[model samples]
Target: MVVPVPPPPLLASHVAVRAAASAISHGRRVLLNGDHPPQVAALGRGDWVKLICGASFEDAADVRNLSLVYTLAGVDCIDCAADASVVGAVNEGIEVAASIVPTVQRPWLMISVNDDCRDLHFRKAEFDPDDCPLDCSKPCEKVCPADAISLKHSMVDGERTLSDPLRGKYEGGVITERCYGCGRCLPVCPYDRIRAVSYVRDPTMTAELLKRDDVDAIEIHTTGKGTDMFNTLWDNLSGSINNVKLVAVSLPDIGESTVDLMNTIYTIMEPHFKGYNLWQLDGRPMSGDIGRGATRETVSFAAHVASMSERPPGFYQLAGGTNSYTVDYLKKAGLFQSSNWNSGTATSEMASSHQALIGGIAYGGYARKIVGRVLRKIPEQFGRVHIEDHPDHLLEALQEAMSLVGPVKGYIPSHSKPFMKQVDRQ
Candidate 1:
């Protein structure tokens, strides 16, 4: 019989150790340049990456772990819901990550609030499962990316019951905390029982959060219908506006009126805007957790905005449909780090401060979905699943996050990058 050779282990412990070191070194080098605030520098370099913890996602345990993982992977900003508890969770995660890699640069903590209730990011999906027909398929449950919906049924004596077809008394409905209100379940529900409940964040509460020392940034979601709502919210937060380093406005693509609306909003914020401003071009909001096609809308929106000569003054970033494929899509559009946007007619604006045409991409649903896979593998017996407690899991999660962030940062697979590879000897 011929001798057989054993394959090397999938991930050696030493590789992880080296990767961690590289992450710290690269993070500091990319983030600590003194030309501007690290995040501002990243925007100017067209490498800024923000991990968006959804404006409505409030699961603290998951948020904490996700924050820790991404912080290690070298994100410039971490955008999350405006809730105090959520903000605390993000900070906790960042602190824990720093403990692991002492040199890891801490990402700016951002809180998201909405001016208009009409914005989809501020809504929640809700319904009563009892209203459904017994024979009806639970399509909503299948479609939900967050796994927020649950249904159970039990069989009766020698027969099936409609009321309890799920193996119990039809005990199923949207889990409030887990639902990020993507609205995917709405169209799939055959009964049309799902309803999206929208609400605006309290400006008073948002201002208070902004005042906190831990919060570094704030993003205002608007419907682009008019600037009256934007003006009102801006005035409400004006007193505390100086507390944060950056103020971001999240808006949708409103066609020809986008630039005009942006200019109007910019004029309103110009006097009061104390720090850097970013325009989040929200394309097909909350659909990133779906699949590849979902990223198209946001990239297309970026292209359209990039082509405009008079696009307002602010760092332009992509949101809404951002996912793994977003970077590739952006490169194809000639907008990824290409400063020649509308060179023939591109009039200088506030964005001229940034070197790149597109500042960066914000990963929301897709970012969570990628890391949530690793998070789910942790055994559930706990008060809270601190990812650091499980070293192996933490390493795996960091790799997943790095895969998404590395491309934009121009991180190559040498020993200097976060993911360490085996060295060959002559």
Candidate 2:
């Protein structure tokens, strides 16, 4: 039997398109007056916001949509996996956002690479569905935030008999492209069938991507065990490091030695690092979507690093478990845009600097989680969904995006007269 497909929501699309246009026009006014692409200024002002499209997430369509929505929302940067196609997808999204609002400043495009295969961000979950017991509950599917796992039971033959009614095998396992190696699936597997496969990006290819005109930055994910692997990767990236406007090192907080490790890494990059550098204090890794509590680790991590008198020279930012609550927590901790050092004792040089104590925050799983809700509304029959195609969905998605971005951007509320009237007229 053939299933009937739902028609596109054309009327909603028209109204939403108008609303989206109004919102974009109103929200992006901040980009118009910046002398140094607002992103850089944001870094200095401590309000920089970046969208991290997971280092292992290579779904081009989702990457493109996320890029478009976040760019319009006024994020300062978009970080994605360091693959040619992924980089192209990010640029495509930025280009589309620019098309919607001519004056919208293009956020810097940052690519993520790993110095070692052990980094969690550079892996994927794998398993054979056939090995899974038919009687066991599929907790792996339920626990997966990315919805990367899929399993269905099918009959061994064309028909099922009374004695073999439950003898079907499982089919259709992990969607590799959608999996970001969260590892939620591994622990949930009843049969212990799930395995994580990790791989490091080739430095040669990453170097080539850096040389691209559209590529604006690169992020190196390191285990923080030592500087040897990072130094090796830096050597491999050598001259290409100068091609970008910024370089970021993403690392987990490793206690008292974190500052020392950061200093060592900075030393390795300082000579050839001809651009702005950033330190991504990755707290709790990929747990942002879990809940409000997930944000605490990163905020606490930021508080720790911000208080350090001799951490390093690069701008500091928070990541790993950031979500909607991050900004509020930062504010509560007195780190949001505060120029004063946490210890109330800034070096003479720091006192004269214009930069904030903490540069900004990067939203990863949580950012994607909020926007992915809207993207999921598009019908499956629509195939590869370009959110812009369904303006109503785009507007909903944009509004959702704004809810997260507005706090950082200080966006004018959508309820303002002009834009509300546009929505009302629709």
Candidate 3:
């Protein structure tokens, strides 16, 4: 009698991929059955999850992969750079996800722009690798969460070897497209060679993007120092403001004046705010990948905002340093999807109507970090990696993404072992 043969690794992975895709589809179908658009209802119910592709991160391939993974995992929105190419990348990812899972709901495509050049989200780290000392320990590479820095020592001449002192040069520096201005590399560099270059998004270009049919939301990053810059930027985009389904303002906690600033910004937006609005309470911007502690600031910011009686109108959400611990923190603070909010506040109406006090969470660095680990496993030999093309890698990445997105969506994967392993590893 002939012995039975086991399936090859590729075929096994393909079966696993199908299983993962089915699980994701089931979760979305369960969460999205309400009368309201799934995103809006999620906002009302406080289970909304958004994937923030960094405001300055413009690597199209990476963005596309990230968008695909998060979209499959059932995020309500995808926030990405305002650049045309970046927006295209996000849509491409979403489209690919839809083709793979025919029933997947298309997430809102949101573009992120900044009013001030000083805003940390609108910058990139720069350094001249050739200037790096041959003997220097490259802490920048190790500390960078984005893997944006690359360095290699090369011989200076035909006679000199890489081992010869002062005979080689550092050939690679910050990969600008991959750098999202985290600034972790700045302080760690012994030579102080790294510099952050900041920029403001062009309003004309942004206005044109808003006119696109696929774009669904816009997030304006403000420093909260004053409203002059905010007013100016808003005026520039006023003509196209009505095109989006949602408008978000991302700002940091500025002590006692935080609520006052939010009200002022709301006042500025009231007239043209024809759609739903959200307040992104950014705690420690771009630090989510650090560890569990990074999520605290955002959670604290949410609690502070939730307690305010005079806060502005609009759904409230947490961002900046959000991670796996954010929901637990919110639950501990009595704010996760809790209809019982602090009484007699501007948000009381939402509470009485059974909407959640805190709308949801936006995972940026932490979200990317989890899935990126799986992405990095994809061989560089396969240039311009479309994640869906590699079923094995895609299955692994989907598992990693679901680990972060599942809890918020109340999704329990058919195979819990891989999901639990990812959560514990993180």
Model 3 stretches astray by more than 4 angstroms: 1-15, 28-35, 340-352, 413-426
Q: What is the lDDT of candidate 3?
A: 0.83
Question: 1-426 in candidate 2: lDDT tens per residue?
Answer: 999654344455545544554565465433323345567667667878899999999999999999998887778999999989988899888877766665666889999999999999999999888788877678998899988888877766676433563588778899999999889888877788999999999999999999999999999999988989999999999978889988899999999999999889877888776677888999989999998899899999998987778877767889988888888888899988787434211111222355677878899998899889899999999999988787777877777777777777666332222332345534
Weakest 10 consecutive residues, lDDT, candidate 2?
A: 343-352
Collision count of model 1: 7
Query: How far out, in Å, is residue 33 in model 2?
Result: 10
> Which model is ahead, 1 or 3, in terms of TM-score?
3
Instruction: Report how far residue 261 has shifted in candidate 1, in Å.
Output: 0.3
Compute each candidate's TM-score over C-alphas.
Answer: 0.87, 0.89, 0.90
Top model by lDDT, which number? 3
lDDT of each: 0.80, 0.81, 0.83
Best by TM-score: 3
Error of 1 at 283 (Å): 1.6
After best superposition, candidate 1 residue 147: deviation in angstroms? 1.3
Task: Show where candidate 2 strays beyond 4 Å.
Answer: 1-35, 160-165, 340-352, 412-425
Superposing every Cα of model 2 onto the true structure, what RMSD results?
Answer: 5.9
